[model samples]
Target: MPRAVNARATVTLLAVCWCVVPPRLAGDFNPYGINSAYWNSPSVNAAYRAMGVGTARVLLDWALAEPADGGYDWSAWDTALVHCSSHGFAVSLAVCGVPAWAIRVPGRELSYAPEAFAEFVCAALNRARTLAPGIVQSFEWHEEPTHAWADGIPPLHGTEQRDPSQYFVAILTTTYRAVKQAFPEVTVVMDGIRGAFHHVDDLYQLGCGPYFDAINIHQYQPHAPGCDDPSGMHLFHFPTLLTYLRFMANRWGDDKPVWVTQYSWTTSGWGWGDIGEDRKAAYMEYVTDVSRRLGFVHRVFPELGVSSSTAGAGSAAVVYDDGNYVPGPASLSVVTTAYLRLKVCAQAYPVWTGIPEPVPLLPAASRACAVVNGGFESGAAGWSGAFSVDASTRFTGAFSARVEGDGGYVESARFAVEGGRLYEVKARVKVDAPAPSSAAVWMELFYSSAPGHLGYVMPENYYGVVDTRQYPGGWRRVCWPYFSAPGAYEAFLKFSLQGEGTFRLDDVTVRP
Candidate 1:
């Protein structure tokens, strides 16, 4: 049975709203959060309150908490939870780092005994119920599992104790079942994946979707400018990060909400990719905005709130580790300023480049709206594809268009446009399958001066692969913006079915 909604918790959350968030934006949307690696630290309530953050993530290491088989130490965790609860911060406990004794092999802590791991989860959650009660809302299984860890620990075992995805499946499924059985209302988040997309893909293939409520991802983009690195291993920008998360969701055929558990810019000698102080502040501002705008993501934890001397130069702390707790360049204003700029740019080009809402180069007195038959009420009058009007499912209005083919596309009629103008295309989409099981549903914008042009002729960059799979069973709103070349005058939109799946699209809008 699901736990009853805690009235007191809701009241507390509302009170927090009054303290931090603006009156207009103070509703259910609260994405600003923090994740700390340190076991015990000074109070972060001041920082959290100042930034309008209501969520706090703390690492709960199994090794530190339990040294013996059933012996438990809840001292530090209890303090952490109480501290957060007192500050009106909802807590997300990340359960990671296997107890040394639980390890079957000396180095393979990640692939610890499943029975022991499951037992530990049940014990820990039970203790949390008594100690923190309603304050502990979410539980993440582990940290980054795919990439090599400090002790050569990967998702799988170092020895023959486990094979491929089997070991990981056992660990995740066991913990998830235990957690749900104990506290059904508590959201279960999967172990965050580092840049190891392949390992995550493998885990999904091994059938790990039904176990968790949300997907956790850790994005540490390269220190390089523009969020890209020549090695192609970098996720340098929020858009690229979103794209990767969506693609992974498409492959799983699951629309779980994504949680960026850790993201930040490290200064020179600050551990990972290095950037300057100004860039760090800018990235912090940009990331906060992206978290709010991206509807699918539930929360974004920006590295840490307080710095630690232990982290040395690689620390991505918004507050200096000095006893005085001085605020660094990456603080609340980085978040507030980003939100302000978003409001300012809502109607304008260079319009927040990631989403489909048209941002214009210059603010026009009157914006132009395109798309002849967006609602599909006209019954395929403006669309061409191996498709038909789908009245069964509609995001809005009375109808939506359905495409059931394998390789062809359902395209919109050409809309007249001026050359050298920027435009945005947005649509509400849903799927019969959780995601495209084989291939992906992709979108492209085509421009041509000639009429009746059937073949796609626009530059390859004009196409964007839609990752509808990341949406967790709802009408996902997708938006993409593009700049028309100096010589192009006409443009149309196309929704291509690259894989075998049924898709429903409605309320298509092309704005310029």
Candidate 2:
């Protein structure tokens, strides 16, 4: 009877455990691959592996693949394939770089000759299969096909330019069919059109949908004014681009798969000329997290390090110079905690319901002064007095503050209206909290905004960016600018804490 009771207790515990754990989806697909060119070298392979990349998309130039019309050269590729296979990494060949001889007209180019291009792709695939039988097989006709075809100067053909869509369709259909027939196990993916979803429709019209097993998209958004869409809505953001792709897949009645073949966020500095380490670290964290959330994102190849010497030319993943490969801090960070978190999340949830629910607001505190802890504790020494404000408050005037602490502190306070015009902000901050022996405290004024919602529209425009600074301690009045638009917004106060000591703030107010 005692043994029976114990067994019953064990069963009850198992049941409770099952109820607490969420159910996981079966057959999750991970698209965390890298774009590695042959020029990247072996160090790149090591870097990619370190970053937890299990697959690489290699460029197979048509010009180089077949230097002479009917002659083929697979020596370079053979070496690369062997190396990648030996390392247990899969390779997705991007067939691009049209050969000059293949163009029908002299001094003219041919975008697609269905039969010839198909033959070339099939031959290459056949050769690859024979050379590297154990390697995972994946293929994309070109990288950003729409951008390449549309932007080429002197155009591919004169009269035939009437509708490049037809040419693209023919090329894709023939190539896909030929490759698929030769290697049924291989996954054929249609490369993304660079600009927008509409370009994808062009490919769809060409009846290219049925031939490929997956669709590939590339996203390269730079953080700068006017570098991206004015809306500030990035494709990497959750459920934005992926949702649209799902709609497209449903429309086609073919849900093969989707792969973000290439995607990256650039720091303000570095490849584009300035390398801001902080920005780089932040961007890496953001992209890797987003990739993990968007399960379909198969591979991400940051254009690595750009030519730092050129300043704004481009950066490659690992800058190769002086016979040593130097990886940027951002790259290293992605390989560490950030990328691992993403992988774990992807494995846990293949398809996300949506963005994780917003964190609940902390419990209210005394007046406008809320006790800041958690991630905020590390920056406590710069804490300033906090204030509560209403719709009528215009926080642009001078503010007085006093704090009890051993260290010196500076008080700079201001308010900036955010979200709706009617919404006001009030902040009191103490900057630069002194060292271990001394404590610093003061008040600073600023606004609070969601990370990715700064430049959106009405209902979504309810966010603001907050900038903070630390200063020496003392009771002094500081004048700061504050204004607002004519809409609804939330009120927030920011405080920075610097040292090991404690400080107190009182008498906070916001006036219309």
Task: Judging by TM-score against the true structure, name the best candidate.
Answer: 1
Model 2 — which ten-residue stretch has the worst lDDT? 11-20
Q: By summed lDDT, which 10 consecutive residues of candidate 1 come out lowest?
A: 11-20
Q: What is the lDDT of residue 112 in candidate 2?
A: 44
Candidate 1: regions farther than 4 A off: 1-27, 37-43, 149-164, 223-236, 270-274, 308-314, 323-512
Local accuracy of candidate 1 as per-residue lDDT tens digits, 1-512: 12122122111111011111111112355556787654243344554555556678988888889988889998878878767766778888888777778877565556577878878877777777787778778888777655422335221223212212425677888878887888888888887866544344445544576877776778776444444221132223354444345445543455556788887666556333455555565666665555545445667787766654333354566654544433343322222222233223332311222222211121111245568889998888989987789887888888988877577568998877655554445677665543323334567778864455533333212221233444434455555444455555677888866555677889998664
**What digit string (tens of lDDT, one per residue) describes model 2 on residues 1-512?**
00011111111111011101111223434445666555234554565565556776777888998998879998777777876876667888788778887776442244447788888887877877787784757888765544422334221213222222425566777777787777887878776544344444334544456766666666565455544331123222323444344434444444444566665444344334454343444455455555444443444544442223222323333332323334333322223222344445445653344222221111111222232321122233323343222122122232323333334343333333433222112233332223212333323443445433332222111111111121223211222212222232333343333343444333334432
TM-score for candidate 2, residues paired by index: 0.54
* RMSD (CA, angstroms), candidate 2: 21.4
TM-score of each predicted structure versus truth: 0.56, 0.54
